[model samples]
Target: MCSRLRWTISSDSLRGLLLACLLATCGDVVAADPAAVGAIAVVVRNDSSIRLMTRDEVYAMFVLDRRGDFHPLDLPESDPTRAAFYMRLAQKNLTMMRALRSKLVFTGAGRPPQQLDMPALIGRLAADHTAVAYLPASDLPAGTRSVAVLQPSP
Candidate 1:
């Protein structure tokens, strides 16, 4: 005895099936929220005069597009939170940021911000009244105050 099965799947149905299979195999990766992976909090020393900042101000400071007494610090490019910060605040990825900075440097427009590890960044923030940096929201230091919280785009 032989049996045959015939079926048709609409384009939407096929797409849904493919999506389900992809999710099944890569759910942990795809299902994870980019914003939830790491939210960034822009901070300054507690005693500093700076109180509030808009997102544009933060982005300008970070990208060296604005010249002010403010000193912008940054985490190393390899740090995951760094990527999250730029993406959330400026809608930029690491490559785009690097390219923009390079162009600025090449044209003598501005220099890239200083890169530091978490401890070093904390120390700088505490020591330099003009310093501003983004830290993982979950780990903000005691002597620092958040100026803005850059949440990832939905």
Candidate 2:
């Protein structure tokens, strides 16, 4: 009975933190600029025919499920911003991310998202239309279009 109570408590606390992270970066920021999110770019491989995306579309972009709609790529957990961005949509929040991604990597559930610095992120996106990843507007790569605005991953 005590274990169950503890589980419930943990779950509730986790949900609360996730909600807070949904509003910020790394579960730390109190607020995020909507325009900043909008300026985020989604790039795909040249082979892919897709053009623009909605928030849901962006979320779907990184799923490795064969039956899934969008192409999901698993990236390393080193970058806090990318991790937070991923948690904003993929996971409920940021807490379980490393464990979750590690588990996923082992299970072959999917490949990790490509971890790229600003230049790499732009270069990768520019090279592939089927490859979808995000980059800030300040460093957006040439040939990449602002497909959609940044949104708290729902």
Candidate 3:
């Protein structure tokens, strides 16, 4: 009887552990989906003196159709946040943007923005007053300030 009782308790404990693990994994999956969240913010160094920009202005800046006093910094193409930012703000996918930039560079008409990963982007923004980049709202570092809040398109 005691052995049967021990086996039953062990089974219940194992079930509880499995349930806990499943719940934890689900939470991580939801958090990993950027689309499940709200919009990202376009930011510059805290000490940057640039004014807030409108959607069109930001689009032009990203596409190299216009120039601004501040240098533009881009997230690496493979970054999920970079994909979201371009889709929401620039109205272009990464492939389209890269093709356009390549054509411009080939013609000597424009140069592409400097590309960096999250940590490097944040560090550069903190040190370079002329640099601007977009990051997820949650990822914005303390030394940066949002110049524009980019909403996702309908």
Candidate 4:
């Protein structure tokens, strides 16, 4: 009886462990699928003379590498939309981006883009024709026009 009871308990524990592992792996798979999330839009002020930009141009502008007449605006680091924007458009995660920006600042090569909340970002874009930013397609404000849609490569 004692041996039988031990076997039953061991089997139950193994089943529970397997279940936990499956659940964890499934969550990771879902999160890794970019199609599961909304698309990101690179935008400029509606009245801006610049109508188009390539992915490289957008990336350079964001990283403060290619200085142009236009200004780049960023959402706060904690915002998920900002994270998605960097990941999709610039092929960078927030931690990597921060490290790069820090190195640039330390070398006096460049500074990070100005961070703003959603409302302030919208307002600034509306008023400044030279300003550029990225936001979720659904969340783009009225006075901004999407210059490019950034998506994961299939």
Q: Which candidate leads in TM-score?
A: 1
lDDT ranking, high to low: 1, 4, 3, 2
How well does candidate 2 match the true structure in TM-score terms? 0.53
**Model 2, residue 68: C-alpha shift (Å):** 7.6
Candidate 1 residue runs with Cα over 4 Å from true position: 1-36
| Alpha-carbon deviation at 59 in model 3, angstroms | 1.3
Please rank every candidate by TM-score, starting with the best.
Answer: 1, 4, 3, 2
Residue range 87-142, candidate 3, lDDT tens digits: 77766766787687778778978777777778888888888998888887766799
lDDT string, candidate 4, 1-154, tens digits: 6666643221122455867686754542213434444878889888998798888888888875564788788876556777777778667776788788878778878766767778898888999998888888877888788998887456
lDDT measured at residue 125 in model 3 versus the true structure, 0 to 100:
88
lDDT of 1: 0.76
lDDT of 2 by residue, 1-154 (tens): 6666643221223455757667545544324433234334555554556666777867655543332444333333344446556655565444565566467667867654545555665566666565666655455556655565554443
Question: Which of candidates 1 and 4 is the stronger one according to TM-score?
Answer: 1
Models 1 onward score TM values of: 0.74, 0.53, 0.72, 0.72
State in Å the error of residue 147, model 1: 0.4
The most accurate candidate by lDDT is 1
lDDT of 1 by residue, 8-78 (tens): 33112245576778676654332333466456788999988889889888877887658488878877665
2 or 3, greater by TM-score: 3
User: Which residue pairs in model 4 clash with each other?
Assistant: none
Q: Report, for all candidates in order, the number of backbone clashes.
A: 0, 22, 0, 0
